[model samples]
Target chain A: MSSRRAPRVHGLMTRGYADDLRLFGSGKAKLGLLALVLAYLMLPFFLTSDFWLSVLDYAGIAAIGALGLNLLTGYTGQVSLGHAFFIGLGAYAAAQLGGPDALNLPLPLWLLGAAVFGALVGALIGPFALRLRGNYLAIVTLGLIFLGEHLFRNLKDVTGGNSGTNVDTTATLGGLDFKDLALLGENFSFNQGYFWLIWGLVGLVALLVKNLVRTRPGRALQAVRDRDVAAEVVGVQLGRYKVGAFAVSSGLAALAGALLGSYQQFVSPDEFSLFLSIQYIAIIIVGGVGTVFGSIVGALVLGGLPGLIDKYSASIPGVSTGSGDSGFISVFSLNQAIFGLLIVLFLVFEPRGLAAVWLRVKAYFKAWPFSY
Target chain B: MSEFLQLCFNGTALGARYALVALGFVIIYRATGVINFAQGGLLALGAYLAYALNDTAALPFALAVIGAVIASGLIGAATERVVLRRMVGQPVFAVVMVTIGMLFILEQTITSIWGFEALNLGDPWGVQIVRAGDVVLAQRDLWTVGIAGAVLAAFFAFFRFSKLGVAMRATAFDQEAALAQGISARRVFAVSWGISGALACLAGVTLAAGPAALSPGIGAVALIAFPAMIVGGLDSPVGAVLGGLIIGITQALTTGYQEDLFGWAGANFAAVMPYVVMVLILLVRPYGLFGTREVRRI
Candidate 1:
């Protein structure tokens, strides 16, 4: 009887490195993932409200961008205020490639093309990261936003100038048109279709990022974040990972921007302002700095806030909806103020953010039998 | 030749305002190692406050400017005390973001009080110009140069001789060593912010001196001043002024010659001119003309 090893606990025990690196090791985890998939497929059908669907769709797009930012900032430790630039780049790319007056490519082609374009531009900017560090890098990226805005306004033919351009692009994915989805003989509305498409892509990005972070390259990124010099001494190629991370992060941002342009059907240069970049930075900060799931979680929480505020501003006290109102400030000012307050409050009180809170809860439950 | 001189004169005036704002940035950075994004917010707030005091309260113009400067200094010190104190040991990224957050709040607070409409600053100088040969200067612009120069000279003297200023320099040199020497790092930080705020107000007053000059958009000049600060070197007061003048002249020249020389660059090219010059300079020097190279960065 002593020769036989005691029965290992299902989750608390791990046999090898393979088990340690498994995405969903326990049966419970696999079941939870299956349930989440079911919910994803079932969600749009029941929650058919246009407003809610739009909110969720936007959240999904923000999730994609935040995921990319997390990979760069949270994992690789590069702060960029130029996210809006890449996003703007993606939107214009979509407009040029997918618009009827232009190349009018299929959905996949245009979207992928936008991502590729963003990656290329991002790679070009990556060298700046090599040259600059910390505050210099941040200010340089801030310059990128202004320079990008200048370009967006001046490049009339491509960007349609400051007046902006429409993006009445198609959303068909080999017979599965996200514009009007029809699955198993049931037709879904435009918002519903888009909700599924965006969220599905979000899931894919989350999975892809998860996989990346779990691998050797992912460890390399975290090492770079922790101590770049130490990482260099330990045989990590600083240039390759740093540049590669930038390319991937910006590529993801462009992907989000393409969706935003297509969904809104209008791509304005002003839409990708420093404020937009700040919003993404705020989202990542609010959600969790470096965690993969935290980006999605943060997006879910903050992505719909502006829309919600805009929708409910009439009822909210101290927010003047129109001209000559009693309230001192407009809804726009209130939203920005709130964002500012949140960033300050979260950083001051909870620097690790909501992800850390969620982890604490999970950890508590996992070790329920013994507090230690 | 007159046109060139005119451009140089105008650029000098513009750069003077930039110098004041960039000096604020340099002081805070030297003391706290923080690039306060909220400096622009403070600039706007100071201008609005001046508007309120001069127009609403009907105070004397000089008194109004003084009051605005003093109030902004208090607010700046209070900000360091209340918010930034919590971020003492945090990384630079977190600290910078906190300032950005403060910026949005401050800007909104200004708008909420003053609204977005461009208002009269109630300045004594109203469309008054002084002609020097073929080059004409607005009284406000001339005063702007004078006030900026005076303030900068005062600051240089203060930093060189004043006990507090020497303490600030010591703290900037080594906070721990300064603390060991019994210098109050906290007092130095608070004083730096207060001094920065006061400078921002003076810049704001100059910027908002002309007729219908006071507006929320006046604050954005601080963002442009970023290039000036970078070009000067983040820590060097002298660099900030020189960088400001260089950028200011370059911008003025670009705008003056837009149609003839920079037609291909599109309209409003002068707005981003400073950034372009900064990039070029950084490519060669990395740390402005006079900034010390970082050794063993923490």
Candidate 2:
């Protein structure tokens, strides 16, 4: 018995740098990826209801934005409340560039245009991070949201002023419009088409971010986040990494906004406010900070919560659906209150957020038969 | 020129209100190192509580104001004890976000309790005006300036002479050193929150006293005051007052002259002028006019 060799765990062992950088680190992870792909391909057909389909579409959009935010705030330790501004910028960019009277570009060009514009603006703002730290940086970004709103409101030619502008941007690429698709001789609805388009992008963006985070710049960002002075002492260029992170994060956010505008077909100045910024912050905080998968999880949960609440508001005891309803709290107020409570409770009780909970459960199963 | 003087008078009155809010921010920030975003909620709560006491409870206006101020102070202290105490050692981002969460909860709570309709504050100085050398000022505005000046004087005196205040300042300067010297850091934190709450109450009362009327949106004034706090330097009380005055004057002047000077900029540009000014100022002095620059070490 003593001479018998221990049973080897094949997929669990990481014996080299190549193994360490593998996207699917273990058998379980590979299986999870396969399951996710299956769900992506098949879930639209299974969930044919318009309500659930739209909800998932919105969640996919939020996931894209949240991934961008997680890159900057979570991995780079930069606190920003101006995400709504960038989102709005992207939406308006789509409106102008993809609209009939303007540049009249197609889906990919407009989305890329919005990202470039967002990156330029982000680069302009990134220098402020060099000069300020902590709370000051946060408040300055808050100011950016207000300024963006003001610009959106007054720029009548571009944003159509207070009444808002219609985003007639098409999601067509290479003779295949996402608004209508025929697969296997079965026609699909707009929501289903968007479900495929948005989630497909979500997968692509996630892969891109995951790859980015595993590389050298990602390590430099984490080093700066842990301690900027120490990072600089260790030969990391603080300005380049800080500014680059902002550019990349804002670019992703703008891409998400372009998708949202195209999907919703409407963009309004009021849509981008302090509350919207707070919502993005809430998503990252609730999802696990510094985890790419956590952003998607958070977006799926918190992003879909408001729509779920709205759909079922009549049944909730104290939620007033209309002005004359017999309840103390309006549906909007209830939603706001829930968001506030979630932020507070999660921060106090589970600082590491839902990702940590998932990690714990996975660890528990991995060490089965005997408690570690 | 007379029109400009009138605008300046109104601006100073507005600045006084901003100064009061900024002062409250400075006190809490100096003591606990947390920028209390929930201060706006406290401000709105104080005004609404005074409204309830005066209109619902049928108390005298002055007495209701006093009662509201005290109650708000206690609420502030209770918040520090209950929620913030647990968050003492967390990162600054987490603490600030917690306060923001509290702000949302408080705002919604006020709306649920008070409803959305605007209510008269029922103060004695309701839309009354006074004239001085061809410049007219609202009675509430005059009272705001006078009261704000008195509060500033009292706070400075307290900081200079009071033993507890000295302990608070010492704690702010260096927490570990103050603790070693037997200063109760927790008490200092609580007291600072309490004082900030009272100041917020006063600012709310003055802001809601005149034609503004008490409403849920009244709390948003604290957002503009954030600019004031930043401009004066986050830690300087005097800087807050100066920053408030500067922002108020700039906003008032912009409103007065936007039609002529900035017509091309767009209508109602004055509303966002403070933010523009803040961005410009921050570009010049990241630490603000009076804040000390932090030293970094590897």
Candidate 3:
């Protein structure tokens, strides 16, 4: 029996609880990680510039939306080309619920309404089209983006048509004005208030998603993704798991949309176009699929890269940041071209994404000083 | 009675164009098992090629058509040899994504050359519409349907009778067997691409003649060809033609009737109607109207 226990695995394995903590399963490591997170959370307060704050706000919104898509595509092996449809649906629901006259409902209720609407709409779209497998599902979802756009453009009364709705900013909760773009206006400004609100929501959502991934439902989703037939054989219901994943993803996407609408104080069809959906998918792929941290990292890279390019290119010699007809227009359009190239290059060379690279670097450092 | 005949005429004409485009998709898919999302981009290339030859190069219409067809054929073959050949054994998903990326590259190239503007290409045969009581029809539309049907028939004859066509078919059916029998599968792939490109050129010419204008958006209509291919049955060429015809006619009728009823004031429904039908049809018959079902052993 002692011979059989002789180091079958090479990792720092131990039987005792304290030994386990010193090796792979360490509470100290987790506490250290939590401390690092706290520092990160505090770092933003030191720099509250309007421009940077606004950028962070948009990045938060994008991360929320991309996280939802990661849940669907990353965990469930489903492809969705119409994710923006759900986002737009949520935005519209938020707008409608808040009402033109501020119908006396709480802000949280309105947000919850948006999420419920998203889940319902997602469930409706899911089972109807997800019955088929492979590229068929992709096409169906892609068509929905078009359909959703057309509906938003044509339904003048409900969706406010192509121009979209200007959501009223009168909703409130517990004597705190919800529509006050600057919650911290006493010290900072409007942009920072929006930034903090978005960041707070992102943190809460991330924690919820982390916990969800460890639960039975999340494991079931992974099983379905890896092998549907095997998962089914093991008593995991395919339709239910897939539909549940869609609902949760859609709900989160809707939350992002609602927040986006609140921040912009407006909602429009163009915000949820096919290009936006493609942008969300590209961010996840570039960030690394199925990773929580990947969503945040991907959002920052996708959102910030173009701005940085334009900012630097304006001063560079021979670089056309402004050429009357040939100069970089807004960094946004240039980013589209770059985005396409990035996806191709990343898929070809770095399929494991930035998170994987980060992991490898950390492991390298940890394994250093031994010189083995 | 004249209205019904006119509807049939219009349906056949529109369907013929879609068939030509869908047929192009089917050829590439049959040979390589890749869903070439770049079909629309290639269609635009064909159209632009013809336009450049006629307007810029100062060639006769007939000569320009031939030049465009040959140029597109070479382009097709080059693409397969260069980009697609590198992705030979990759998963189907990756290959599909590569084609999607190729779409962006093709679009950028065309835009860089042509500028993003709609250009008119004059009719091939100096044609005019023949109007009857309560109905009118263009000679070009008739020519389009006739030419499309003739091309389909010619391709069928080629595959069934010609030695080269048989060789291509053999390669398509089983590359290993074709190689064992001394037929070069790569050469067959090039041939299929060439034929597919020629078909795209024909469709492009017909489309340019219709509105007498071309735009980047024109290539987008090629997306309709995918649904048409699936609706017709991916494995069957004849089904592609029939499927395209059905989709085109249904869309035309829907737009025509909607205009009569609601005065929507646009042809947008005509554009989206085929996709709607495609989704509905896919719901009932995922393999498509004439598509084959594959058996997988786990």
Candidate 4:
């Protein structure tokens, strides 16, 4: 029957508008997504190592932020070196709104509060993009980092000053405490609960971003990114899209920061420096620019690096584990060096990033019989 | 008034160093159309090299400085050949990130070799002072000003008269046009990087020449120079120098008047004063005081 071969993976058949916009158009993709959801739910149970779980948790948090950066830098053609500033803002917002001393709101409220706070600030800063472009815009944003750092350091009450403050916020959702979960009469550790919570949020954010980029506004953003003047000429309201992208991007960053603060239980000004911004940039670069899936892929690849480096530092040669050891480089320096090297190597060799590689593999499979 | 003059003297010394670094930034930006964030790394490397030659190897201070400058120049040129050439046609953001990547690598390399501990630079101008008309100037500061003036003047002269200078300007103006006229873009790029590295090294040497100034943290001055570069104009050498002096003097005045003038702003307001000034100036003059405004053709 023709039904057996009704639809093909790469068939050039007439497709409806709904088919074009479908996230998982192919049966294979839908099945793959189902498999992913199953694995996401089940991974924490099988992989119970505290170290690895924490790594995944952090990676999930970073993925949320990286997705936002991709939307800004990839989709909207804006390069912001002040991501760390916005992240710090979110962290502080969590500390203020969710901490026991402050409003002490629930998990959802704090997270949304932080995101909204970051978005408002990001909107305020977006108008500068209208006046400046390219290198000049980049430098102005760089100033934001310094100014933000100054504020973080001096504003002792809200940010807890340079010494940092505790982020002891409760993470509960409708009588289900993530910090201590009870599922089907089985008690789960904090790590297990966190893995589920963090990854679950990652999935939600990823879906949100994916849907956003598939719509008319998404096309507007891409146009602005490709050529702002042309996009404007073509009736794309440059200001609204640019500012909206920034707000959304920064909101995601703040959400990540809120999670990071809640999970770590502590955050200082030092945690949100220029290096943190660079790290996010590296994540997007190594993952794949302008791709939602690439952001998560990049975060997953780089998220566990520091943990892995620290774990194996004792065995690595020329790595001083402790201060004053007879080694050329300390473990910290080595980790940073590797990060820098990864950025350089990835940019030079695999500019399209790991996502592109995966896409190529998929393409090759799609053209299996007539591979040229 | 004397206190003000003293602060001015110190500011001038600091400004000279910023001028050198900013000049290097201008050279690299002009030639390659990419801001070389790795200048700080090169600055640290050159300063360390000077320290090694002067103290560890027991060479004359002047000779060691010269050797380090030459080495840094060659290293800069080699880096352009080996690493940056591959990134020639990449997006501006990508190229900028690449240099930032280089910055981290270079900084870590310096720390791995030298460790994080502060080291003495062993310059002859140690604690030596010259008093002149209500202002007490360090011998090193005086020498720094003198050297910077001479080197900057020499560079200006070269840029004004030399064929290579003309070639660099031509390439900076229109890369494809210069290529069509038979100018080797590669050579121009490499030489620009070399000159930038040389300028960075000189800045480093001057910075490290004073007592207890040769620390790993010395490289951070380049970050402040960013503001100086922007305030002066990205493409103008004279703008860079002026911006440096403006930032340097503002910082010095803030530091000097911290207790009286900036008490409410909190401690160490001077450290961030340059950025504040840069942002304020940029809001009014987008292209900076001396920067050429871009004329975009759609």
TM-score for all models, in order of appearance: 0.97, 0.98, 0.86, 0.97
Using TM-score as the measure, what is the rank order of every candidate, best first? 2, 1, 4, 3
- Give the TM-score comparing model 2 with the true structure, all chains together: 0.98
The candidate maximizing DockQ is 2
Candidate 1 lDDT by residue in tens digits, B1-298: 9999999999999999999999999999999999999999999999888888888899999999999999999999999999999999887778989999999999999999889898988898899999999999899898999989998999999999999989999999999999999999999999999999999989988998886478888888998999999998989999999998998999999999987986888789888888899888988888888887877431
Off by over 4 Å in 4: A1-18
Each model's backbone clash number = 1, 0, 0, 0
Q: In order, what DockQ does each candidate have?
A: 0.72, 0.83, 0.33, 0.74
Model 4 residue A268 CA deviation in Å: 0.9
Evaluated with TM-score, which candidate comes out highest?
Answer: 2
lDDT for each residue of candidate 3 in B1-298, tens digit (9 for 90 to 100):
7766677778878889999988988888788877777777788899999989989888987789889989998888888887777778754445665666666657666765676678877555445887877677787787888889899999999989999889978877888998899998888888887888888888888887756577766777777776777788776798899899998888677766767765553336666677788888988988788877654323
Poorest stretch of ten by lDDT in candidate 3 chain B: B262-271
Residue A52 CA displacement from its true place in model 1, Å: 0.6
Total clashes for model 1: 1
Mind sharing the TM-score for model 3? Answer: 0.86
Interface RMSD of each: 1.5, 0.9, 3.3, 1.2
Estimate candidate 3's alpha-carbon lDDT, on a 0 to 1 scale. Answer: 0.76
Task: Estimate, for each residue in B1-298, the C-alpha lDDT of model 2 and write its tens digit.
Answer: 9899999988999999899999999999999999999999999999999999999999999999999999999999999998888898888778988999999999999999999999999999998898888899889989999999999999999998999989988998999999999999999999999999999999999989978999999999999999999999999999999999999999999999999887988888888888899889999999889987888887
Supply the DockQ value of model 1: 0.72
